[model samples]
Target chain A: MTTPLYKKTAREIRDAVRSGAVTATAVTEAHLARIAEVDPKVDAFTQIWTDEALAQAAAVDAKVKQGVDPGPMAGVPVGVKELICTRTGKTTCASKILENFRSPYDATIIKKLDAAGAIFLGKVNMDEFAMGSSTERSTLKTTKNPWNLKCVPGGSSGGSAAAISADECAMAIGSDTGGSIRQPAALCGCVGIKPTYGRVSRYGLVAFASSLDQIGPLTKNVEDAALSLNTLCGRDPLDATSADLPVPDFTKALTGDVKGLRVGLPKEYFTEALNAEMREKVEAAVDVFRRGGAEIVPVSLPHTDYAIATYYIICTAEASANLARFDGVRYGYRHPGAKTVEEMYVLSKSEAFGPEVRRRIMLGTYVLSSGYYDAYYLKAQKVRRLIKKDFDDAFEQCDFVMGPTSPIPSFEFGAKTENPLEMYLADIYTISVNLATLPGISIPCGLTASGLPAGLQMIGRPFGEETLLRAAHCYEQTSGITLGEPPIA
Target chain B: MSKITKQDVEYVAGLAQLRLDDAAKERLVREMGDILAYMDQLNELDTSNVEPMMHAMEMTNVFRQDVVEPSLPREEALMNAPVHDGEYFIVPRILEGDAS
Candidate 1:
């Protein structure tokens, strides 16, 4: 019997397709078979496009046989986050309100990937409207961590993390409102990048927080993340917010050398609040970077403690405004037999949205309301500016900052669900980057004593992804932490 | 410190247009209270002269071209709507004297 091919990276599969060792159709069938075998247990995909993916792969194979050159990512299996629009597939954002909705056009990022000849595996599950820190808020199905089924993979990109961890797809694209991408990737023992705000187009990503939203890549290694970002990052006419800077060759920058790079260790990040195991693992990873010809220095972000509260207020305010369009009249579920439009609008949202989403909406409306705008929303925005200044000052002395992605590794599924404050605190270390619009990447550093994975985050200046990718690739090469796979049930 | 009361929660919910049930209101009251208390940490930081920033970097006057561009077809734009009436979206009557 031929061996199944779920464990190969996108680059490896691309090589096989290029050398005629494995046809694109064969690679597509292999991933579909793997999904058929494991998706029921992992519950990663909200909608599986088996026939479409297969046909796309077959078309690539036919083109190759006819001596026509496909693009760089030809036949690579990629899972799109549920929030991204796909022309021929359903894009529900994992919410019951939009269960029947199908986008008539593809998102700009999706178009880029499609043009590169990447196979669309499916849309992965996420928190409803990308609000919560756990996938449990998804109205469709909870995506379980492939490593330990009882724990969450982290969210609102939980399904993307779970799919990459379970070998369901080679790479996935996720949107980070705060730590959505990095948190999930950390918990699931994969690599995820939250690119600089506006580095990638947000044209068709269902808006969560317009000002803070960014589309980035999640993969098994930093190199693949770099490769995916190479294809995904560029200015798009459809998205006015996209950056107009020159796109760098991310893959060529992965030289596995960080000689003389200044890596700063933030004192506020490793405070008394951090879990001991996570601290040890993150520190050890820093030691590896120090040994890799990088200079380590101590840095302080004075406004660090205010990041969580500030992020919640600003993100929720933006979310309340962004989500106001789902009024049952435009798109999403509607309540039947309502006597008035007001009642229908209220009933549809009341029934469609989950508790966390509703909570944020209420808080946002409260903050943005006439009476409290200066005290809450405006104050948060002011503090957000200071937070950016803190990073700006710190970067004057250091090239990049290193920290633990989450204070603790993946907790149990229901650990912080009851207390919304606890869930908000989980994003403390990762929120400041979004507020500052900086680039950050999370790579698996080391495993806890209990065998759970821990992630070390590297934050860089705006448009400094090349430096961050170089540093992460250097650590990854020297640390030799194998990308652990989930035990097949 | 932010003094949020049950009435405040209800008022905010009203502004958001969300009709929360009795159980949800009670739950939100307790949760929001804790959240607000934690937010008191901001009171400790001195921001007497700090300017509030709405965006991260300096980006202004980002207006697009005034030239006409192709837009989505009417049917494609309305494909995802739950209900629509020809040229406009259909909704339950919001006003007392409005005819459906």
Candidate 2:
């Protein structure tokens, strides 16, 4: 069966627009119509830029009329995560602190998407300051999983992934601090790629954890993820951490051949903690590679159990420092008529921050405090080094490591909310990738008995996105699991 | 690990410039203890000789030429300020209590 226009892949939209089979205006309108039809059920968007999107789409059509090459992603409608700054509207990061704040400049990735002729649909919701795993932490709105409206789209990129799954937008950009991108994509039955740290510029991505945050794409398929990465990767003088290495045309990496590719199965990831159904799906995904003439080797990342603890320390510490810039003096929310500066700072933060964000900030402050600094923050940093080394050692015996993207499939909203430790544990399988600074992708492997989708994750060497994309593309093609439209779709 | 006390939560909250009420403080004390106990597992790793991986990429002192580029207009920069006086953001008194 042919997919609906709203459900079409980004490449299909770009192809039709480029070949004059359809106008970019029509493509943009179809998506806007889809958003209007289904967004209330999914709650995937924080804002929908109908007028601005149509204007941008009209501009694309005008360029085509003038015989201008409108760029690789020409006429594709895309959503930018609310945390990624855009000049057009408020970038709230799903927190009340910046509810009315408008970015003065576009993020580096936003500029790149504009250059590529991608239409900015609008900002999507996320966990407040990208803190929680389940986007139940988003103060703005509750974004439900498109697959099962009662279940959560695993977050902090919950809205971004859900938008793609619900066909609200062809593709969306999401920043993964821990498993924000991959976790949500896995749960929502789509593709999400978190490129190696420094691979994509984080110039205007509102920092959650400066070290772990990398902006990437959540899309309908692996090919679209590769295409979006091609647009996003490059050096940026504005971001000192952006890599100086040359970016390869990521689309060129999708040869769909896994012959001679050595995939590693991390023994730590396939433990009893994983759900039985999800484990079976992941094993089936690996078998596809093995049957395609690729060798599967077993490897061990002994530090796997320590990943959650280490991640919480380092991520929270960095977040505390990064978010300190939000004091009332400069911009964002402020408490009116406070007697002293300290009181004003206290009141403003207390009112604007959600519970989880405040809890993390306090924890961060404690770890980085004078007496406990060495025991907590410094020790976690050293453990982070061990995590990175574990991946490095494993990579020597294999080209890429494979596992389940999340320990279990998507759970009901508020299932793990009361216990923060339990919520943090849900990120066990995905957090180590960020700690090691490696590129990782999550693709829908198969569906559970109840019809929920399960994702298989692939990890590659630092800056090894090309190899990662090649393997993902090959598996996505041969897996034969049809991309079923969600209930809302 | 010893359980974090309400006193510890209050001290950290003060340092972070956040004001938590009695209920928030009581809950945080218990939550914080559980989190810290879980985090103590890192002590099991023999990382005495390992160097901290601070930045993902091993680069330092990324310097650029000392040239000024056009910056955001003053109005645009203050656009999001809660209480701006058309030129600068207005905040509470810094030094004295009555200096408004």
Candidate 3:
């Protein structure tokens, strides 16, 4: 009953590859074969870089043969969410605008992964411009939840999360602006981390909301998340927002000792909005920490009600400004036969962007408009400060805050498509972390009654990922709930 | 709560440089109204004295060495352009009567 090569964590695969138990090419082949077998039903990947992956894996194998250290993540096959730029492949962000677009540069994380000897399996699908809560907003294709093919993989990192759950790759990279990374990972039964805002560089990650977005890893376990975070972190000169701080090896945090750790349970998060079954499971999962000698205290984030409103206003405002760079002038999709420059800009964006993107853009443009700035945009920013202070106040009494990642488990495709606000509410628990600029991790605690996965979210202070990973690892060790295999095979 | 009308959608769409047809415009009007109504709850919180927090990190004046670095070459930069001349990006005429 050993785990399959494709199902093993990145650390396991990397160790096996470096130890000569398996060749890097063999590891890549296992994942490529798994993707070929499972990805058709899941539709997690937008492109599969067979040749490039094979070549990179072969290079790692060569380094190993020469008795040289092939790096920490040698031969680990990884999925890059399409929103993160990869120089060789298309970085479409699952939108028609960048459908044929190839990035001229690699994102800082991509470069770091390559240097660490991880093989790029190709670009995974995402929401169009990473704007929606569900992958249904992707103009490229709808990525299905591997747990239940009919349900939507919670998104805009749906494809990345699905890729890991479907065992198409050892691990994947995803960006969380709000809950894109953690929500999908929670739904797909994997570990997702949204590091403290500046912990990972955002150099070439396509900005959905500049202030909220952070690049993180989706993995089979917390150790692999810690391992991947080790490679992805560290400041980059190219990004001014990147934290100029020392990155300790995150794997060392997995001591599996939660003896004196104080975990906070936000009362607002466990309200009636959370599905009863989900709340029960999350509480049961938190009990694991309590039983493991960690103290659980109920804390209040009074501004919890304002998080969705503040996040929507601020994120959309930032998104509108960031996305304005994609006009017909420089690159990406261009509408042909425009009578004027204005016509070209309008037609190109209107035709290429999906409905969610367009709606956000319009909402953003309105909020930042002349008369509405003080009322909406500025007000949201002020509220954002209050929201951050709520977390600051809570952390004074507790070490890490805990809750269910989403109020509801995975929903049917198109269920929330008609109502964008309903979809936005799905991120109720996770959005506040981004607003507060803190690190958060979602680890699969248990399955819902319907057999779908639900995750327990743990929020940490800024650069407090080490403590979060330590606590999550301690729970993963004690909970005795192995990640369920998707019913695809 | 402010109602997002068809005229408001059209006006905002103009500002965002997006062209929406009648069906899309109507959908946006409803969706935007619903979203705005939800967001209007922010008015309930008293944020009068709070200063705006624009970025998560409190970074100020991150300076770098004033030096030239390798950049995307012109050919690679223009590779994805739909309409590009040999040297410059070609665009439709902007002026009403004059060709530049």
Which parts of model 3 are misplaced by more than 4 Å? Answer: B96-100
Give a tens-digit lDDT track for model 3, residues A106-129. 998888999999999998988888
Model 3, DockQ value? Answer: 0.83
| Regions of candidate 1 where Cα sits further than 4 Å from its true position | A1-4, B85-87, B94-100
Candidate 3: give the clashing pairs: none
Report residue A453 deviation for candidate 1 (angstroms): 0.8
Task: For candidate 2, give the lDDT of residue A306.
Answer: 98
- The per-model DockQ list reads 0.73, 0.84, 0.83
Give me the candidate number with maximum lDDT. Answer: 2
> Per-candidate TM vs. native?
0.97, 0.98, 0.98
**How many residue pairs in model 2 have overlapping backbones?**
0
CAPRI rating of model 3 = high
